[model samples]
Target chain A: MENKILNKLKNSLDYLSGESISSDLNISRSAIWKHIKSLKNKGYIIEGKSNKGYKLISCPDILSAQELIPLLKTNNLIKDIKHFYELSSTNHSAKELARGEINNGTLIIAEKQLCGKGRFDREWISPSSGIWFSLILKPNLPPMEASKVTQIAAAAIYKSLLEFDIKVNIKWPNDIYLNGKKICGILTEMKCDMDRIHYLILGVGINVNLEIDDIPDEIKDIATSLKIELNKSFKRSDILVKFLNHFEILYNKFVLQKDISEVLSICRENSNIINKKAKLITYNKEEIVTCLSLTDTGELLVKDSDGKEKLITSGEISFRI
Target chain B: MENKILNKLKNSLDYLSGESISSDLNISRSAIWKHIKSLKNKGYIIEGKSNKGYKLISCPDILSAQELIPLLKTNNLIKDIKHFYELSSTNHSAKELARGEINNGTLIIAEKQLCGKGRFDREWISPSSGIWFSLILKPNLPPMEASKVTQIAAAAIYKSLLEFDIKVNIKWPNDIYLNGKKICGILTEMKCDMDRIHYLILGVGINVNLEIDDIPDEIKDIATSLKIELNKSFKRSDILVKFLNHFEILYNKFVLQKDISEVLSICRENSNIINKKAKLITYNKEEIVTCLSLTDTGELLVKDSDGKEKLITSGEISFRI
Candidate 1:
């Protein structure tokens, strides 16, 4: 009853007929006014007088299901949206949710994470100025192939940034660089059977409106935010909406096409390390190698001076300036 | 005080030296006799006499840290051995322990797991008749190179099983086959930064003494236990000890060798599908390809009839035969 009254009040802002809203929603005029006051306390603005009913003037820049749902454009890519004011980690919550038979594309977004986690159990500081979210995807691929999801996500973020005319480069494995500084990171977690992938969670963190002072000194030299790079403040909600839209398109292509070599080709073109001299490091040894190409399965092919080509499936390689 | 007394009793298991045992541990004679009775109930056979000391005749076939520690031959590979009678999952416990300041080569062994997990979040039924355990390794490799750890573990298990004159075949990814049926599975979970791996938990499950009826009906066609294959009972402790020794040796080789191609070569030689006709299935399409070889970094190379070689990093491939 409260939701209906609130919706009517919000709709009235768009010049919705008050009489129609009252009759259609079967709510009293006084009840609508009361709900409007409640919505105001929840960071929603109303315009006009009681006689004209109400109009939604603005919404707080918060990550709520109500706020994100209206902005998301994915068909079924985001079946459900869960919002956490604060959490230990969005990945931890999403992992537990995945265990409970949640549908693919379920998303868990948090405004702040008390114990945000980075790769290798490192601490991720997720304050309100960043986007901290995990999306559940059940791709019909083997467990090993699950790495492609991360690649696709990186491409999606790259494409989304291209919309804002922001120059971006994807670091191999999972980092987004802007002006030689990392602005985003992705962590892909997967559960699989021997031959098939059950589900995967793509945890993404983006520094949006974070100020330089908000970043730690150790990472300040290496990390930068969109606000810092662009020298202007942008809406976090708008960036998220753009990301979801771009992700939906890329993800659909990945699922439908199965082979992301074309996408990989695009990523390689925009990537800073392709066809460049790089230092490859594995568990056993490190060597100076030349980047050859990316295989269809996303393996990085590199050749040594002796012309010995190696297909690297997993490892960290850095481009040497 | 009680643990010290138990330790003393375990060390002096020759005769019922009640007065000597009590004096050595500063415990009462009645308390010593009570502990002996408890040990008997838990499957320890002790011979005792009024004047003679206690003698350990035999022990029950249960996996315990106390029993496995002496059996392990690795220098620091088995640095810490945690034994659980039953737990949710050995992998979960091992991962949690790895998050702490635990050393590499820590092993977590469980006789049973109520919610044993497999790749892709599938449930692995680990009864008392199976060897359910996880080993923590902090290999100094990049995250991408961690796949080699899986290959190394599979090779070690295959080689170890060959010692028993069992004709075992290496299954692609990580499974050991005995006479065309799966007897063991390995799941490798890793924590890593972009450049380096923090730790990895390699969970191994082996069907040792399970009867045919013990396996679920759905998996019965694909799974076989040692007892079912060999038509006899084998000692679980013996196999565990052998695996630890083999793992330590292989891990050392992996860390010390300049390149992992030597190990990959062994894995390829032992693989059942190499050079065989197989169907590779991905989300987008399926193709019949001939298994060419495994790349040094662990990608399976397959050649289509058109003579184009494709490196398969992730997806399901099955033998057509």
Candidate 2:
């Protein structure tokens, strides 16, 4: 009944009357008043005038399903959204969920992660103020093409930030940067056979509302959060909704029609490592190379110091920014 | 005590007195007699007399750890051997074990599989007469090099069968054929990230001692066993020991030395699809091609109908034979 009353307030442009809400939801006026009091205690700003029953001013800055589900515009890419107050890691939870009977686009979000992980099992500092979530994807693609999902995620983040008039560049594989500092990171993990991918977990962590002191001393010099960059705090749910909308469009193009032109265009325009001198490390060999461009299939094209041009699929490339 | 007595009986060349046996182990004569009686009840053939102590005539044809551990000749690859009376699938058990702190060469064997699986989750008929097992491998290699493990498994099985004076042809990827029938199948499953592999489960199922009537009616025409081919049952433990020995050598070379020359030579010499026209199927596309040879990294080099040479990895190639 509280959710119904909240939904009614969310859909209203003006103040809603108590009698109309009671009649619409088949509840008593006293029950509606009690639910409104509960919503206010839960961090929802509701104005209850004597005549104008209630008006929802704003939702909490939490990624709960109640706040995120009604805001998502996706059709199939996001079937369910689950939010936890705290977890070890969203990727760990998504992996546990993928082993069972699960639908594609099931989202797992956590307010804070105690043991967050990045690519190559690196430590990822996730606090309650940041946005950390994992999306389960079951794309009908082969395992060799699995890395493209990471590229799509980078492009989506770039596109979503562009909507806020905040320009960010995407690093080669799946890192987003603003003012030459790391702002977001994406880690793509998968379970696969020789030819087919069973499932993929796309973990995204964005430093949304973290202050300078929240970052550790070791990485503070290289990391910057959105609140630090923009000099103000922004709602994490707003960014999540826009990212999901942009991701669904890009993911559908890559999966359904087998096209990545839009994603390529966005990535190429906002790429930070393209045409830049970087260090390429693969297996046991390391060399300096000038990144030429991104291939049609999202591989990095580079020219080594010896003037030998080669395409790299999987590696770690660090730019001297 | 029972295993110690069995080991002593196996090492003896001729019958010994009961007094000597009891004195050597510092146990009473009645205790030694009780252990020998227990061994006999578990299907061991013991020759005993009132004066002469028991002698081991033959061991039961079971793939138990007690029988297989004593016969294996490996240093690191076969660290632990676990045999279950029955399981749903050896691969399933190995996967569960891989999620924990398991050693590299831990072996999981089942006397019978109630729901065995082959490549692509195809049903495999595994009875007590067959050799069904999964070996957990933790190779320090990239994800793209995973399919080579399957090829190594095929070469190992082929080499083991050749010791029995039965020449078998290795079908590309991972299958062993005898007399133009399917005698063995290998399935390789893995848990990996984009850049590294955490663990790999190599599941092998060989038709060792099954009779003609033991096979399912649907696949009886295509499957054969060693007993059916030779009209005599071979010991399952013997075949398993040979396979483990051969597998350890090949796996070590691939992981430690970063070499697969031996495996490639074995595969190329006994390849069933090389130089043969076969139907090549890959991700909804099928074509007729002539297989040329095996590459150094264990990929199939083939020429399609257009005379274009291509290296085939991770697909199904079926010959008309």
Candidate 3:
């Protein structure tokens, strides 16, 4: 019912009178007024006068489920969206939710994360204005091949950023860089038995419109935001919806069509480190290697210093950042 | 505190008088009587006569923490044991416990599992007579190398069962066969990031003294118990402690010593299916192959019918029972 009024206001260019809005929907004028007041409280700038009624000037950059669910393109994916004003970590919440009978593609979003997590249990500062969310995927595939989900998610994120003019680079495994600075990160966690992955929590943190002063000094140079690069703020809601759209396409392709060519191609476009020198660390051995190519299963193929080619899986590759 | 009274009764060969038991325990006669009654309720046949006081006539085939923790020789392992009368699955319980501040090496054992889980979420029938438990391991190592934990557990189980003089063969990946029938299976689940394993739940389920009538008709031919083979009941408490001791030793060797030789050796001792015809199914690709050898990471090496040797990782290899 609120969506009707919200959509009506969104579509209206001129002022919408209370009597017309109420008669068109057969709702009370007082209820329409109440809904308009609520929308205004949620940061929707509304211009109202006794003669002109109300007009929506703008909408805030809020990642509310009421805002995203109606705009998402995915059918079975992300229909049930959980939005939190503040949370410890979306990934933690996703794990707890995935343990039950929750459907796949259920996303957990937070405006601010007190204890956001990064790779290797590292801390991820997820302040307001950044996109902090974790998508629960029950892609019950072989455990060894679960790494492909990270690649798919990276591709989705990379494609989502293409609509904007910002140049993006997806670092191997799951970090995104914009203008040679880290702008986004993906941390994939899974609960699985020996044979198959039961579920995977893909926690994604995007520095969408964060202010420079809000970022910590330790990573001020290394971290960046879309607002800083574009010299303007972006609606996190738009980026999030775009990400879910691209993600739904890629995920369905991988699950239904059994094809990951787009993911690999997108990753290949950003993975310009081929023939570049890097340090590859696997197990307990560290060696200098030259990046060669990616395998069909998202593993990195690198040539060791001794000129021997090795397929590196589940390893850390460090290059000159 | 309960262990103190339990241990005193276990030390007493014939019968300890209530007066002596109370004096030795520094407790009142009523206190001693209460402890004895509790022990009796837990399937221990405590025969109480007028003068003989209390005698532990017999003990059921129960895997009690009171009996096992006292005998386990592993330091810092299995010291914190939770014994449950019935549960859905010990691995599920272990995962919930691991989310807390519980230390590694904590064990969760249940007398019966209502919904015992097998590899790939298959149903594992865990009746009352079976041994069902899961060990929590926080081995801070690369996530891909977590498969080695399954190998280590299989080796530990094999070594622990050597005293029983039963012919046991460890099928590749995680299955224990006795005289050409399935006797035990291991399901290793993990909570991990892309980099390292946070915690691993090593679930071990063994059909110890299950009767033929208790066995489901669907799996009667494929499943057998120790009682079916040896025609006698074995104490589950003894087997659990033995497995924990072996597990601790092998785990320390893998984590502290950075050595997996003992695990590989023990696995090879029971993995003698070389030159035998088997169907190897990996990633949905099935082929008729001959079992050749085991890899350092517990992957099976097999020779296809085309005389091509291939490494089989994360697959099910089925041979004649």
Candidate 4:
């Protein structure tokens, strides 16, 4: 009921009074006023006056998929957005959704994830203010090529941040760094056979408007949110819309055109670890090598200490500025 | 109730009368006699006389997970088994099981599948006599190295068939061919990120005792069964136990020892397409090439017509006798 009133208020942004809202939604004036008050408390700005009923001035910093779906401009992705107030993990939910005949670009977002996960099932600090979501992509590619989604994600997020006049560096495969600290992480999980991909759940968690107090004590030194870095809060929906748009553009280039040049170029242009020495860890073996460049297949081409060129396909690399 | 009677009968292989069984199990004598009659009609050999009740002779060709469980020797793979009389697909069930905190080596086997699935989501005709099962294995390896599981499965099935004195050729990746017809197929699906494997469900479908009338007309030309080739029915439980044992051994060596030597050797020795000319088909291209050898990384090394040596990672190859 509140959602219907909120949608009506958003639809009639010019001027909607409580009397008209009550008649339009078949409710009482007090009900309309109560929902409007609730929406305002939830971070929706409504200019309610004597004559002018409610005008939506601005949206709050909430990762609400209902609000974000209308703002997403990507085609064939996130057509059906499953929004949750809290979830165990978006990727886990996406995988269960993938088991069914779910379509590509179906986005699953949660305002807060109690057990958020990163790559290799690592714990991710996903606060309520952070943007946590998972997108199901059924690419017409083989399983071996599914690893390229992370690079595409980096390209999308890096380009989206650039539109906001905030430049961030991609830390190789999946993590984005801001001022030498982690700002965003991408965890791409796939359900696939040897030759064909069934579906891939790209779980992206971005620290958009989280404050320093929202972060945990363990990761406080390593994690930095956009609000803390800029000392100002930004709307999460705006970043998501920009991200899905950029992602759809680059993702088409990858799947349709079979071209990854634009994604690689963005990674190269915004890379801070390239040409610097970093520690690469695979399984249990660790080696320090000079970061060379991103390969055409999206692998990290580096020169090891033995002066031998190695292609790091799947591993963890820590970069130091 | 029926399974309990079967277990009691199996435990007491000696002659046991119906009156004694009824008193021991606290059931009516007529109930035990009816279940025994049903088991006999379903293919269990029991000796019944005037005074003596029933004596177990031999197990039949039914693919019963309950019957196969006691015969299995694997340690951690299948302690908890889900036996389905019929399922959509065992891999689908196994994948759902993998989504939870399902332990490693959890197995799901169905006596029949309503909608069995093969590689690339292809339809697999699963009749009642065929062995359709999926095993969930959580190996500590990267997702990039998951292609080796197919080779491990091929080796296990190949060695298991050899023990029964039935010679068959492995058709490249995961198909077992008997008398130039495909007798078995393997479909391996993984859930993972770029760097680590979460869990893999290895689906093995063997046409062990499928009759001629049971085979579909469209696939009759290219498919065969052990009973059709050998002129007799083989015990499905025997094959399942042998496969589980062989797979556990090879899988342990592959993951723990990091030794794929045995698997590679089996693949090479029994591969009929290793030195033959085959047609390779990729996403939108096809080329005829001479198969050279299996690389250490489990990729097929082939030489094209232009004297170019190319390593093929994921594609379909059709071989000619």
Q: What is the DockQ of each candidate?
A: 0.22, 0.62, 0.70, 0.67
Residue lDDT tens for model 3, A1-321: 777888898899999998899899999988988888888887889898889888889987788877887778777877478989899999999988887888887889999999998886789888998999999887757777778888898999999999876669978888888887889999999888767788888899999988888789998878889888888988888899999899989988897778999899888778756678987766567788999988777888889878899887777767742
The regions of model 3 sitting more than 4 angstroms off are A279-290, A303-309, A319-321, B49-52, B272-274, B281-292, B302-310
Candidate 4 is graded, for docking, as: medium
lDDT of 1 by residue, A1-321 (tens): 655655565555375545666788787767766766877877787674656556778878887777777678878788888988888888889877876779998889998888887665677778888999999888876556667878888888888888888879887768899998889989887654335656788999998888989788988878899998999887777788888998888878877766586668766877766787888766556788888877777878889878899888665666643
Give RMSD (Å) of candidate 3 vs. truth: 2.6
Q: Which ten residues in a row have the lowest lDDT in candidate 4 chain B?
A: B60-69
TM-score each candidate.
0.81, 0.91, 0.93, 0.88
- lDDT per residue (tens digit) for residues B53-162 in model 3: 77877866677777776678988766478889999999989988888877787889999999998876789999999899998988878777788888888888898889
Residue B208, candidate 4: how far off, in angstroms?
A: 2.2
A227, model 2: CA deviation in Å?
A: 2.5
Candidate 1 deviation (Cα RMSD) = 4.5
Candidate 2 regions with alpha-carbon error over 4 angstroms: A13-23, A26-42, A47-54, A303-309, B13-38, B47-53, B305-307
True contacts kept of each: 0.17, 0.58, 0.81, 0.77
Interface RMSD of each: 4.9, 1.4, 1.7, 1.3
Alpha-carbon shift of residue A23 in model 1 (angstroms): 6.3
Tens digits of per-residue lDDT, candidate 2, A1-321, equal 787888999999999999899888999988888998988877899998996678999988989888888888888889888899899999999988888888888999999999999877889999999999999998877677778888889899988988999999988788899998899999888877786778888999999999999888888877889999999998899999999999999999888888998888778889988888999977547899999999897888999999999998888888642
For candidate 3, give the lDDT of residue A297. Answer: 73
Model 4 spans with C-alpha error above 4 angstroms = A1-14, A17-38, A50-52, A69-71, A287-290, A303-308, A319-321, B1-14, B17-42, B48-50, B304-307, B319-321
